[model samples]
Target: MKTLKIGLLGLGNVGTGTYEILAMNAAKISALTGCEIVISKVLVSNINKKRSLNLPADLLTENAADILSDPEIDIVVELIGGIHPAFDYMLTALQNKKHVVTANKAVIATLGDELMSAAAASNVLLKYEASVAGGIPILNALSTALAGNEFDEIVGIINGTTNYILTQMTDFGLNYDDVLKDAQAKGFAEADPSSDVEGEDVAYKLSILIQTAFGLKIPPLSIPREGITKVSKDDIAYASQFGYKIKLLATAKKNGSTLECHVQPALIPVSHPLASVSNEFNALFIKGNAVDDLMFYGKGAGSMPTGSAIVGDIIDIARKLDCLPCCLTPQISAPTKLIFAGEGKSMYYINFLVADVPGVLGKVSTIFGDHGISIESVMQRSKGKSEGEDVPVIYILHESSRQQLDPALAEISSYPFIKEVRSILRVEPLN
Candidate 1:
């Protein structure tokens, strides 16, 4: 068997896992792929820093040139999490005629098209199976296994940090702040978790998923994104009373020529498969023309799980060396117009805290009626309990367009009697 040399960038959590897996399963991986993966060099910020894995000091270097300029390095695996230096290094690696594999969703979502074009031009492969929902192989499945089918919908919980927080909140009846602090303490979230909590992380993953499933690359910021920060205990409790569980959902659905995509907090039916995917686990719900519906569930992010995905890419690249390719090259489909209008509507749950007055309810109802939104269900606090106090009212709106609801909701929130628009959770109807 021939040897496949790998130059890894970043010796952090993912990098350490990749090295350990390759070193631990060297024999098994060699046997399966008919090739040995050698870690030729690793680029790190510090060469003398203590690492989890014991490695020869000669293999570590602080400079990217040590790895990128090395002609013996067949593939460059980037585990660095950002788009700046990681993007530059990967581009240089591709320019040097090396196959590239990355686990950076930010880079892949934003710069993947450029990298893919470069790879095609150089006839080298660019793989990113670990970029989204780590180790689940959803991207590979979408590009290879489900390539022939045209998918109409793709929804998933792609961020583990946010998922963990939401799961804790739902299970413990904890508020967002309390659950977020717990998540941070548990190392599932960061000290400054604006990226994950604000839904930017899922947007990156969703953008990549849309690219893989639909063959059209899109900017992450283009998606209508709303994070879980607004989610409260009341939202979770209200969802449960209505037979649903609140989750931060990344959704993309095709409507005629347009693809409606967004990242937001949504209420999934309690008995649904996705609702059961809680506590840092990720699940993808896909609707394809041929396959109908497919769900993939697993740990979304972890050292070993993500490293397993990275190594899977390496093994695939190794197996194809000097042999016939079994899997097809990724097709780069032309970008299509992504329109968000006329998409199917869903029942919305809105928590309203209004003044305890006689006509307050009537006024809010008038707003809903003006927008042609009928109330399917209503739950209000008792009338005689407190006068002049803010009364909590929850309404499940009948199916209505999101575009229409947004304006009416804006109008309703402006009333002086409306103390707050507590929450608005979209209820996903079962297919």
Candidate 2:
């Protein structure tokens, strides 16, 4: 069997896992791919830093050119998690006619099209199976297995940190701050987790999904995203009372000629498959014309899981080494001409505080009616305060667009009887 050499780019958690897996499963991988896969060099910030894996000092390097410019290295696997030097290194690798595999979602979501085109020009492949949901193989499935079908919707809990926090809050009735601190202590969240908690990570993953599933190039920032920071214990309790669970959802739907997408805290029905996916696990629900509905669930962000995905991509490229360059090139279909709309109509959970008065509910309903909003359910709880004091009121509003709902909410909030608009969350209806 021939030998396939790999130049690995980072020695972080994912890089360590990748090296260990390749070493432990060398015989099996070689047997399956008919090639002896080897890590020729590993790039790290510090050559003397201690790692979990023991390796020869010669295999480690502080310089990237040792790998990127090496003619013996057939594949450049990038595990660096950033946009600057990582993107530049990957681009240079592609320019050198080497196949590039990356686990950096930020780079893929932002610069994938350029890299794909470069790979096509250089007669190499650019694979990013680990970019979205780690170890899920959802991207490969979308690009190859389910390629024949047209996807209608793709929704997922793509960020493990936020999902873990939300899961803890919902299951234990803990406050957001408490669960977030616990998650950080458990290493499930970063010290500065704004990217994950603010929904930017999910938005990045969702943008990649849009490209793979719909063949469109939508910028991650363009997708309207609301994070889980606003979700509170009261919101979780209210969701349970209504037979739902609160989750940070990344959603994209094909609606006629428009694509509706957003990342936000949504209330999923308890019966839905995604609701049960809790604590560091991730799940993606895909709706296709031919396959109907498909759900993929697994560990979203562990070192080994992510390493498995990266190695899987490497194996695929190794197996197709002799294939024609044109045939091996990725078919990122032409950008579809779909209009992008921000968070389209859906059932909404609206919670607010209103004065404890008889006519307040009627007046709010009147405002909703005038704005084309309908009430599906209503819950009023007395706080045992004196007369004319504000009390909590929750409403499950029927299908209404934000354009209408915002105006209605603005009008309602201006009234002296209205105390606050506590929360507004989307209710994802079952298909």
Candidate 3:
């Protein structure tokens, strides 16, 4: 049997899991690929760091150069979750003609085009099936299985931390802050949860998904991002009443040559497939001209789940070693005219705390009418005044563009009787 020596970078949760899975499942993996995959070397920050995996002493090292310079290592699997050394290490590995498999979405989203070019030139395989949705194989599905169809759009609840927080808020009536603390306590969120909570994590993942699904490459920062940090208990209650569940949705659609991408908290109808995905699990909704709409759901993040994806890539690469092509051909070019977020149109759920008086609704309705924004539905609830103040009112808009709605909001905000606008969330349709 052909033997494939592997070098691993980092020995954290994911790295240790990859090592354990490969070791425990060696016989099955060998049978599947007809190759013995061995972890020949590991690069870690501290060789003295207590690793959960009891790897051979010779295989562990503190120096990354030891692994990268070794010509015997056939494939390098990078599980280091960061931008700095991970980016430099992957680039160097590709330059050295070593095939690479990684689960770092931030690195892939930011430097994927350049890395793909490097791998292509070096005739080495660069696989990142675990970057977007953990264990779902969404990347392979988009690049291979669904390649025959013209994809209309991709809507995903791709970030697990945000999803977990949203699920808590919706299911248990907890606010964003409370759910976030719980997520951190449960190890679902990091100490510095800004990346996950502020939607940067989803934005990074969406960048890769957009590229794989539609051959689009847009900077993560370019996508408009709004996190669930501002989603209050009141918003969750109001959304539930409207037959909607609030989710952090990452969306990408082709607008002529422009591919529109954004990550934000959206109001999805409860019956939609994405709305029902609760907790740390994730679901992706893909709309294609031929396939119509399809959903892929699974664990979004974890040691074993991510390790499974990495192993799958390793097995596939080993099987295809000398038979077909060494590297995948670039399937699609970057779309030239990708649409910006503010240019897209959608229905909105606007909750305004307006005056309870009779003419107050009429004035607000006239302003919306003048702006050509329609109200699909309206709900007004009275919170008994603690200090004898005006009651609050909520309005849900039917459909409108930012161009039309922004002016309307500004006009409404300036009204004398309006106490406060509690929240405004975009409503994503099921069909």
TM-score of each: 0.95, 0.98, 0.95
Model 2 CA RMSD to the hidden true structure, in angstroms? 1.3
Query: lDDT of each model, Cα atoms only?
Result: 0.87, 0.91, 0.85
Among all candidates shown, the one with the greatest TM-score: 2
Cand. 3 Cα-lDDT: 0.85
The full ranking of all candidates by TM-score, starting with the best, is: 2, 3, 1
> Model 1: which residue pairs collide?
none
lDDT of 3 by residue, 337-382 (tens): 4554433778888877766577888888899999999888877776
Higher-lDDT candidate among 1 and 2? 2
Query: Per-residue alpha-carbon lDDT of model 1 for 271-344, expressed as tens digits?
Result: 88999988989999999999999999998888999999999999888777665442324356535566653235
lDDT value, residue 2 of candidate 1: 82
Question: What residue runs in model 3 are displaced by over 4 Å at the alpha carbon?
Answer: 255-257, 324-343
Q: What lDDT score goes with residue 227 in model 1?
A: 93
Quick one: RMSD of model 1?
2.1
| C-alpha RMSD values across all candidates | 2.1, 1.3, 1.8
